[model samples]
Target: MSTPARRTGRPRSAEADRAILGATRAALVELGWGKLTMGDVAARAGVAKTTLYRRWAGKNELVVDAVAAVFDEHLEAADHGSLRADIEDVVVRFATLLERPETKTALMAVVSEATHDEALGARVRSAIVDRQKRLVLVGRERAQLRGELPPEEDPAAAARNADLIFDVIAGSVVHRLLVSAEPVDREWARSFATVLLHGLAAASSGTGTAPAPEPAREHRQKPAGSV
Candidate 1:
């Protein structure tokens, strides 16, 4: 068989790509989704509009990637030695991200539009929701290792439980922050983690009363910065 000819083109700059995404986030913060434009992002990124379009299909796609990047930046798992502590810690971190005006605004806008747009929905699922779910998996694995949770006889059930936990954690935080227009702070996170831990304990023991979860310690986090 004949070898195919090598394609020739200049390589895209990774630095420029990071700059563009950072610019998109800045635009969202300053102008919001409605007011933001390709020209604005290009100028903020110090790149041509063509450069952005060359990388991303449109504003929606670009914003999705930008939001995903921010989420990735904040998605961290700290081994706090106990399930309750770990859950509370991660929940506080997540709530911190939710509290950000830029992330909150952009995510809700994209999600609202995603209801009607299949491609956007897929992007949000793959980029945002799925990535965040890893927090649940990691926590679950840690809990099992510590004997905080019982071993699963069925892998399918374990997966389902993880999904349910993810939904409860993420959905409650979103609803409280966006719909209820309430703040998700340390107290709220600890309470939520308490309820979650108790439920998991009951499930594992098949009993009405479970041991009280360890009190969650305060987590001091730094602010997110621009690139």
Candidate 2:
């Protein structure tokens, strides 16, 4: 996500930044990602086109930051008192956010496009995915503190465990809500959470273990100038 740039070497305007991102999402609702443009967003935001150019290189970066802003604001994990409750809260919350017309349409469009654009994919992962992963980490720590989970002796293993949990939660919600066109209400959240927390807590207790990942078959060559 590109930071909104300073205007003519002065500090950036938080108000203007908010307006621009707000305008972007609003535009996505009306026009969808294919038809939204920087000029259109600037017009909606009541700002000069140059103001947008100063902050973002183009539409891809702008839309990404716009969507990122929404996720950051709306999708935080609340203290639900238990891992199951937290998972249920997060799943329902994520579903509710994606149910919004602007977020549903815009995020799906950008993610589809990002499949072919590595840099854009990384931006989506960093700006959105990584931010959500932190919430998972926070919730996991809370579970540990409550004695709902044991502390992994290896830090690296703990990190991997968190990553796996995040993938499962995100994948299940996105597939159910978006692809399956199904509801993700409290009942569904509870059932799903029960299943997920079962294997998760079981593994931590040594009653079950996650299967070993298959070894990588190969490494693809990185693109030029790629990180």
Candidate 3:
């Protein structure tokens, strides 16, 4: 009789993977890429170094996986009917995510490391670019569907414009995060969205009156003279 084929797949534990990713994010936030070590992650995760190594080839893989997890949880692609709503959703979400101290620290660590590590830079680009592109595509499609964009407008150009809005939102937050040291909240997000929508609408219409102001609420008069 032929010997039974050996099992090829290793049984992996989801719980262990979560712990490892959590540990890796924590380590990156605290120590950054240059100082982070696998041993440090092991200690923080309460897992043996062998267990981590069994799953990831090295620290780079582990860090990349952790960053991916963060993005998956935080950076959602929203479809809110109109392009304006979609842009608002993205800006709001971006602002909210940047306010998280751990997330900010971890992202900064990845960015700093990307300056010197080509592999890490590629990983970062892969993690962020396509996801961002999807958001831009959604915005462009919505604009076309709503007739907000010109019929002759290039989809790629529309997408690029969406990306520009994202750049402003992200740039403003990063500036405050790095310099002013103020935490971004819903109000700030709203303002950013308002500004971005106005700019996009103005660009599309070739008019400055893009983000039409919200109508003022009128106070009701008490029947003739009675207060």
Candidate 4:
């Protein structure tokens, strides 16, 4: 006799994936990477430890996935038909994400783990590089399309300016969060964008402006509003 047909059905539940990510983020915030345990994640997720393990190889993998999920959820590329609008949108969204206590805590946890975990470091670098590259490319292309950038304007320089915008914001936020300085909010991001854009536009116009200021130190500090 012929065997019965195998069952065909819809894929896994989206709710479950969200639950796992949510639980993982919560656990990281509460316990941090060193103290976080599979049991804690399972308890927060309201699922069995076996289930959590089945979905992720270990705490590192879970943390990586959680960070990726948070980025995807919060950071969206803005195509506002103009470079300025796009910059504003991205800067605002970035500041908003940094302001989130859960996101900040989770980021610190992942960054701390990356100090010793080579694999985790690679994952973090890949995520950051790819996202930054995408933003720069999109902004540069849009600026070119709008004829805002001069014909002789270097695409690489324009793209690098986009990267610099993020660097400034990240540096300022890190300074506040780690050193207990003033918060890096929307205003700071706007100022960064304004200065960077002014320099790039000046370069394109063939009118040299004052030399840019020296970059700040690499070590991060805690901002006023950080948890």
Give a tens-digit lDDT track for model 1, residues 1-227: 99999877668998998899888887888897789999999999999899888889899999999889989988788888878788778888888898888788788878988999999999999999888888988887766655566666698998898889999988888898789988887777766776786765465554534576433223222223623
Consecutive 10-residue window with the lowest summed lDDT within model 3 = 215-224
Each candidate: what lDDT?
0.82, 0.83, 0.70, 0.68
lDDT of 3 by residue, 45-136 (tens): 99889988998888877877786777677776676765666766776676677766667777777777788889988887787654556655
RMSD, each candidate, Å? 8.5, 11.1, 10.2, 11.1
Residues 66-141 of candidate 4: C-alpha lDDT, one tens digit per residue: 7777877778778887566677677767667766767778777778889998998888777654565566566655
Highest lDDT against the true fold, candidate:
2
User: Which regions in candidate 4 have their CA more than 4 angstroms from the true location?
Assistant: 1-12, 150-169, 176-180, 200-227
Per-residue lDDT tens digits for candidate 2, residues 1-227, read: 99997666757798999999999989988988788899999999999999999899998999899889989989887987867778889899999999998888779878998999999999999998888898889887776666666656798999899899999999999999899999999988876776686655544554333332232224222324757
Q: How close is candidate 1 to the true structure, as a TM-score?
A: 0.83
Q: Against the true structure, candidate 3 has what lDDT?
A: 0.70
Which pairs clash (backbone N, Cα, C closer than 3 Å) in model 2? none
- lDDT at 96, model 2: 96
Q: Under the 3 Å rule for N, CA and C atoms, how many clashes does model 1 have?
A: 0
What's the TM for model 2?
Answer: 0.83
Q: After the best TM-score superposition of candidate 4, give how far the Cα of residue 124 lies from its true spot, in angstroms.
A: 1.1
